[model samples]
Target: MKVLLYAEAKRLLSRSGIGIALKHQMEALKRVNVDFTLAIDDDYDLAHINTVGPGARFVANSCRSKNIPIIWHVHTTAEDIRNSFLLSNIYSKYAKFALRKIYSKADFLVFPTRYTMNIVRKYGVKVEGEVVSNGVDTQFFKKNEEKARQFRRKYGLTGPIVLCVALPFKRKGIHDFVDVAKRLSQCHFVWIGSKGLASLLPRDVREILRNPPSNVLFPGFMPQEELVGAYSAADVFFFPSYEENEGIVVLEALSCECPVLVRDIPVYEDWLQDGVNCLKGKTNTDFEKAIEKLISDKNFANELGKMARKVALERDLTIIGEKLKRIYEEVLEKHGKKDE
Candidate 1:
């Protein structure tokens, strides 16, 4: 089910004080008697249904045939846009009018972050939606300062550690991150993710990180359980990406009481306050300043770290889950299946 894809929708509802449906989809079939079904092909069970993505392209057609309410769990990529093909990729650019048509007809929409919301809004998609940020198991994210150091040591780092977790995606701005490591030579730098940069990085920097000049460690993509410990060991969480729906790691870092410094992005900005929840920087100069500022002002950095943790605590799924559950009930009600 869609709930299991990101793996939070169901958990969020189960948190106390939020009421969730006991059954859904096929389970609803058992709960109530139904005559015909209007289905989408995400699940191959429905034999008679339209098989379009977004389900918007066939909205006019579906509306004419059936009177069922629609609920869509949206995940937007550049492919969904009609204008993406303008450059080259077919999914990137196709038909702008069709894209607008889909947005206009959708009955209900879901969004994970303002970053995702902004993209859909580009095509004038307007509908009531909830900001269901990716959820993390807070009980499991406690910081392990000693474990962090040990992992640093195991990775061959022997200095203050800054950990960047992810792949070599250009939008993540790895080049910018490396530039920071170059400037801050006293402390160690660590990159953890799927691929190692041993081949890509300049030998001098790689050598320093690997052996001497201050201790830099690269332990490419490990299990999340180990990654959580790695996060526990680091002094700060640094993410300098250009695009992100919501930095799930930010929550993980804050839950672990680690200081976080990220690019001033919409998803981060919406939840974090500069100099308050976490430190944010935009460009080379901006990141340099944040790194320097957080490193030099230890007391200030600690204060900001506590602020970040507190902010994260305020939105624990235990509390925010109620909003999602309420929305789900309202959506089902619109189908003449539930009542006010």
Candidate 2:
């Protein structure tokens, strides 16, 4: 069997955590190399998929045209109603219509979370879909005790370390992170992304934004191994997205045995339980309190981290890949029977 790896913007995902995921796909493709031919492109035969990386739907219809089974994978819902990325008729007319094309034409749909699946459902895109959690390599996520210590020593951090990795979009609640950092002066705060907020903030916000007394670090665009080490070094992982379709980074952190602290959202309960796998907080105060509770009580944090590792072990590549494999086999078999 031959498979096409078509993505419009692979470069956007390079070297970031998202890139790490793309790397895993590349390696798995290597293992399954004999069974398939992975070709990268958006423009091809009508059956060719115009993939926007792993989960974007642009390539779905392209593949469907050739009677190929297309996987409509959409990574981001990307609804910026507050900022308004689309004009009135433009969105309801061509843009959404184009998305509908990808949805209706595909044989199946794949999403990272139920929240993202609901987004497509809300748009009235009727398609068969499943939530396949992104996979993390167990070997890479193991406890690097020595390496973690060395990373902490190099950074001159001895106390608790809080890590939040994400694009600096307004919706990511970067301001809230900064506030949480300022509220806790004894701890060190780390930011791992730089997609939004290049512009200077107002002076008052600057007080919180400014890198303080050797406590805040903005180590930009790290390689995959280094990032895994960073997660190992962290005592707490903060995922403060105002909206998320099951944050993939959360899985990565859990694999590293770092206890995650996320804003209370519907998706969290679907995958993660409060106090069972993580500590979920709803308000800004709630988040800060959760951070304090985690940092102040080391034993609780350690227990939570172990539970997180357990979660990751269950959801790692060994498991998630099976889901993908089954899906692919079903797709191929359906077509084979059709041909018969």
Candidate 3:
């Protein structure tokens, strides 16, 4: 069946997690040979929408009017939106209301993680939902020493590299990253993502980006090729996000077999085991200690990286694509039965 895969603000979200997830979705669909198109105006049997903007709402409504099944990919929730940008917290309550109303309208809901599904359900969203991870392209993100060296040389990054891939926001733990960087001055801290909406960012976040610690570097957004090299070059992939539907960068890091240290949060509960596949921390002090341990003990870090790659294998794009294909067919069959 032809599926309409739609994401609003395509260019704007190109560097965001939602955008990256959408890219993965496209790649997944391609692998499964699913007939899909991004053009919202294209005719299709089913629609999978990945944004909460007015355009997304219009598409959902149009699909409903046509009796076509709509799969709302819940990439953002009110809970995760707070502390994101300026006035984001003030807008979160309204976002919850909008999300509830729109989610209720969908024939199905798609959550990237069970944690996110539970949160949306708590928002009074009762629609049938499934947990489909925002999978990574393992082939592209695997470790490459030559590429790693090229990236390190290009950025003039020397010594042990601590990398974090995320937008500069408070909720993303940018402040905490800076604090940890200060504590671990021996390692080079590189944050590889964009600051696109700088005007909307909180003043304090802007100040931190303006005057970061000597050890920390903000090289802005990198192309996917460069991202693979960054992950390869990194001695540690440290993600301290306070919240996420599913941090695609974490999966990317795992696919590269990069040793990862993340915040002890609900989204990573079942998948990420502390001191097993990856390390988890709560505060800056916890992060500091974890990084020190990973950097000092090469053998332990290598073991963790191996386990982390295994985790990535389970959520590869091919697997996610096949799951999406099944979910689409199941929904279509049910819709057909209703029509019959």
Candidate 4:
């Protein structure tokens, strides 16, 4: 069956998590040989929309008029949108109201995590949906010793490196990341993200980025190839972000067999196992202790990394593609368009 996949604000969110997720999902659909197109053609059997905007609202209305089953992919909520960028907090309530109306119009919904599904429900979204992870590309993110060494040498990261891939926002725990870096002077801390939106960051956060500690390094954004190498070279993937629908970088690090230390959030409950697949930290001191434990105990760290890799393999692109294919077929069947 043919499917029409669309995302709003493609240029604006090119470097954001939602953009990355759309790319991965499209690639997965193509790999599975599913008939899909980016355009809004009249001959499509199903429509999947990934953002909320005027264009998206028009598409949703058109689908409703044509009796086409619409699948709404929920990537952001009001809570996660707050503190994300300039005026995001001020507009969050309106965004939430719009989301509630948009999601209620969908025949079916897709949530990247159970945490997000529950959040939407609490916000009075009555639409039904299932949790499906935005899986990672294990082959692209695999460990490579040569590339890892090259990245380390280029960045002068000789000691244990703690890597955090996040946008420059207070909600992403940028301040917390810097605080932890201050405490651990011996280890090298690298945060890979853009500073172009520094105006959106808090005044203190901007100051911290401008004059960070000697051990803290802000290499800015890197290409995918370089990012794969960075993941391979790092000893720990420390993500202190306060919110996420699902942290795709955590899966990327896991695919590279890197140990992870993330904030203790409910979203990770389904995948992350404390002291097994990865460690969870609640506070700055907790993060410090977790990082220290991983650094001092190489064997335990390796064990956790191995487990994390297994989890990543289960959520690889190939498997997720099959899942999407099944979901599309089921939707078609339910709508009495299976023969189409």
> Which candidate achieves the best TM-score against the true structure?
3
TM-score of 3: 0.98
Q: Any residue pairs clashing in model 4, and if so which?
A: none
What does candidate 2 score on TM?
0.83
Q: Clash number for every model?
A: 7, 4, 0, 0
Would you list the C-alpha lDDT of every candidate in the order shown?
Answer: 0.57, 0.67, 0.92, 0.89
Q: What is the lDDT of residue 143 in candidate 3?
A: 97
TM-score of 1: 0.69
Question: What count of clashes does model 3 give?
Answer: 0
lDDT of 4: 0.89
Top model number, lDDT: 3
Q: What's model 3's overall lDDT?
A: 0.92
Report the lDDT tens digits of candidate 4 across residue range 73-179: 99979889887777888988788888898889888889998999999998798876888889999999898888899999999888999999888788889889989
- Which of the two candidates, 2 or 4, achieves a greater lDDT against the reference? 4
Structure candidate 1, residue pairs in collision: 84-92, 84-93, 85-92, 85-93, 148-233, 193-221, 209-216
**Candidate 2 overall lDDT versus native:** 0.67
Per-candidate TM-scores read 0.69, 0.83, 0.98, 0.96
Which portions of model 3 show Cα errors greater than 4 Å?
337-340
Model 4 stretches with alpha carbons more than 4 Å out: none
Residue-level lDDT for 293 in candidate 4: 92
